[model samples]
Target: MSRFFQRLTFVLAATIFAALGLGFALGEFGMFGVHAGGEQDGAYRQMHVYAEVLKRIQSDYVTDPNINTVTTGALHGLLESLDADSSYLTPTEYKIYKNRPTTGVAQIGLIVSKRYGYATIVSVIPGSPADREHLADGDVIESIGDTSTRELSLAVIRLMLEGKTGSTLSLSVVRPRKPDPDKITLTRTVVSPPALSEQQYENSSILYLKPGELTAARVDELAAKIKAAGKTRKILLDLRDVSEGDADQGIRVANFFINQGTLAVLEGQKFPRQTFSADPSKFLTSAPVAVLVNRGTYGAAELAADAVEDAKRGDVVGERTFGEGSVQKTIEMPDGSALLLTVAKYEGPDGKKIQDEAVAPTVIVSQNTDDDIDADNPQPKQGDEILNKALALLKAKNS
Candidate 1:
């Protein structure tokens, strides 16, 4: 963008932001006892600056500028400045985004992040093509479809992996052990994440329960697992890799353990204080439980961990969880563009926002990246560092 346009866009954004009505910001976050006139004075001063910039651009610019482009780009950048999750979709992107079906899309089912100048697979969804391909944690995906994943944003890399069902993606991945990257092709399909899995060490009272991505139905499945684990001396609830589930379902999962008290709290600028409390009738477990978390543990799973740790009902044993709980409001612009803005955030029992601060584990046992973690048949046994630590804690408490 030209300097003239850039200046115009910046001024335009400042004006639009003022016009958006920040009544709550002033009332909730600003200095108390400050008169409304004081706030108006500040806004007027900024508006005056905006006008000056616009006037200079209109009179002295070398070429005739497109007002529409300038305004749109300004608004786009303004939304983006709000947060990483906030995005401005262009009209073309909006069309595809809105038309996209909620039915599961074809995806490699990897939670990835930028690491070592490439998209690294943090975890793979069990039963998905990525899991079946034996993609392990800490595996850095060097390239996708001939383009280096390093050249793309994590979001773009994820989009490239997801499409209509039956689509295929070729990946060049470098496992921590491999000296050379391995070339692999995975065919995507609807991945219904396994809700819950249960296992007991042979001739041991230690029952391990792993709740996969906390989908709506998974809550019931988890309750059943807890019920069937009946009278187990020690319980290990593996929340590692369990993220991206419904907020309400997460509260439900917490409710299963917490008889009463705040399960989760939601607050925002426009949104009211909505506190979800536990339902005593839904309480499912009083047995000592241990929660295993990692950077991959997100969304609903994070909430579940928050409850378990806060209520003193269980010990969280693993690495810090990925803070992913938030309420996003997607506003469709008049031009068919949209802004996905975070309007509210999930708060833990102690009132810390989940999306801002990760839930720290009581016992921080981080996994060795190269350690073997069996995804297909997850039975946390000896040498499974995080789970073993969790088991030891639960057992010590049980005895």
Candidate 2:
């Protein structure tokens, strides 16, 4: 038993030391905040604890455990503990992630993130298969196919959810007020994001624009609409369920209305602070504006909404946004595995990390949670409550 323990300890120490040496050689230790002396000693102590736990699991288990599998699980849990965006991919998974097919890949249109160690639906794209199936936000996906999501990394879960068009993926989901997971099979399809929804409320005085996703094209559509609406119209930008897009697009979107002042800031331990200021050329209108957000609003949309709110360029209405705004750096390991580590995060004008502190609406309007609906009837029981509130605020400003 002593011999076995000594061998395990030696192997663990050797592996950790090699990793530390590689990181130092590559100057990556600074990104991970691993320094000399006290911090390094603490890290070694924690590693000893991990080894002890593994030793117990190997020796005193009901049956002989696979140490490799156990170690992989521990690595997964460790990265997830840091943040939802950070993940550890095995060698096989890293290959898949690196060579992931970009073109002709279809999806169920569910934007997912890890929450409580399970894959949680952040938003369902409008008119997509998931949307048509009534898969709403906050839905906990217990498993994908036969594999439990709890055992899968966020990257893996996302990869499993995509495939050829017309292909189907099975899911076990636990929704609000549901005790057990319901089995669901969603047909994957090439989800075409609906065009920027534009409407005129209160006799054309308020130009309401809902860009379902903050794609570059969608922002371009928004710019055109804002310019066409002219200075007389009050802008009502609804960023609900707008999770997909490049972070720069969000910055560009905020620059549309904000002629001056800071829009958002990006910084990290090693990443230099970059303050995104509104370009005078990009500023479109000085019209009264109110941005509407909900729990479904995430990533880039959160940045845009928070920037507007922080700068006081517009009133952010509705529920607090789904907190997510971080840039990840993919660090490849010597063993061919990889780590998707969040190196930097976006912050609003108020200097709050969007990932840590999501955008809070200046005027809070909660979504109706009591409404129960099935696949046949997907719409909520209540009307557009958030829309009504934003419209009221905009009209009051007009008055």
Candidate 3:
């Protein structure tokens, strides 16, 4: 009933409804892109239900319920109901977001996603705070800095991870096989993932290159490495646990292998469906290249994997990749914050949408344990299973 509460509720409701309306328009035009949709009548009915519920909580709920909490929850549900990536950004949270530097916002270095209302660690950047702590993938982040991550969106979670270097963020992580969640704190640091690295498989001509993170700089590094390894005839591009980059670099990596073909496609609401074609001139090598992938393989790495599989350029070995292929458009708001929206979804050359259909391996190499293995650091450290599998297949091809 208070004026502040009333205003907060109204803004939350209006912004969510407006976003839905915009999405609907985009969907109708094939530019409007979201995974969920409904008829106009249904939309109106839901609006009514939301309004009535909100009013009831305001007037009759016990303990003068926190209106901000209620509205925030509603907004999260509204966007999330459509898809995992959609979210509503509050003005305050947006301020903290916009203020951060574009390059190297301080971080603990863990790729994450929302699962069952909590942030689940998808992958950890090697040499990062999370990796140093042995924060295995699938570890559920219960809270960050005294706040539970259960209600936080991926965007907000990311924002929370970034801060001044040396500033520590507290985390309560529920790791697999652990009875109780463990308390962990990580100091923010400039997380610079490695560009491209190469090591020859013992006594084999096959070169294993791990392009750690597929950023623009890393792409150039990849080109140089490929040139250096000229005519090597056998390459195993390890893409497991690769991220911290954009889709463009993924295309560039694919371009190095594929010659003259549609590398991938993009579709969205608000943007015309577009195709990314690769020129024969852009092709780097046709040498028998095999890409190593696993569940840790995500984002741009998925693009690279898809291209290799689609173009028949190489064999994708190890486990299936984490299919994350969407381009986010961060729109700054009048109140000095932003709306981070998923404007488009990526598809492979064969037309399989990365968001839905993960890039499965050409040759499935299942590991004995399902312990969310880190692609950067394999267990047992000795006879590496996936790499050995790739080496055998590559050697067979040469034989």
TM-score of each: 0.77, 0.90, 0.86
Candidate 2 residue-wise lDDT at 325: 95
Query: Candidate 1: misplaced stretches above 4 Å?
Result: 1-77, 112-122, 131-160, 166-187, 202-204
User: Which structure is stronger by TM-score: 1 or 3?
Assistant: 3
Question: Compared with the true structure, what per-residue lDDT tens digits does model 3 show for residues 221-306?
Answer: 88887777776557789887786678889988999988888899999887689899997777877778889887778889999889
User: Arrange candidates by lDDT, highest first: which order?
Assistant: 2, 3, 1
Report the Cα lDDT for residue 13, model 3: 40
Q: After superposition, how far is residue 96 of candidate 3 from its true place, in Å?
A: 1.4
Compared with the true structure, all predictions reach lDDT values of 0.73, 0.82, 0.76
Could you tell me how far off, in angstroms, the CA of residue 145 lies in candidate 3 after the best superposition? 2.4
Best by TM-score: 2
Q: If ranked by TM-score, best first, what sequence of candidates would result?
A: 2, 3, 1
Error of 2 at 130 (Å): 1.1
lDDT of 1 at 302: 91
Runs of candidate 3 exceeding 4 Å displacement: 1-13, 22-38, 202-204, 331-338, 367-383
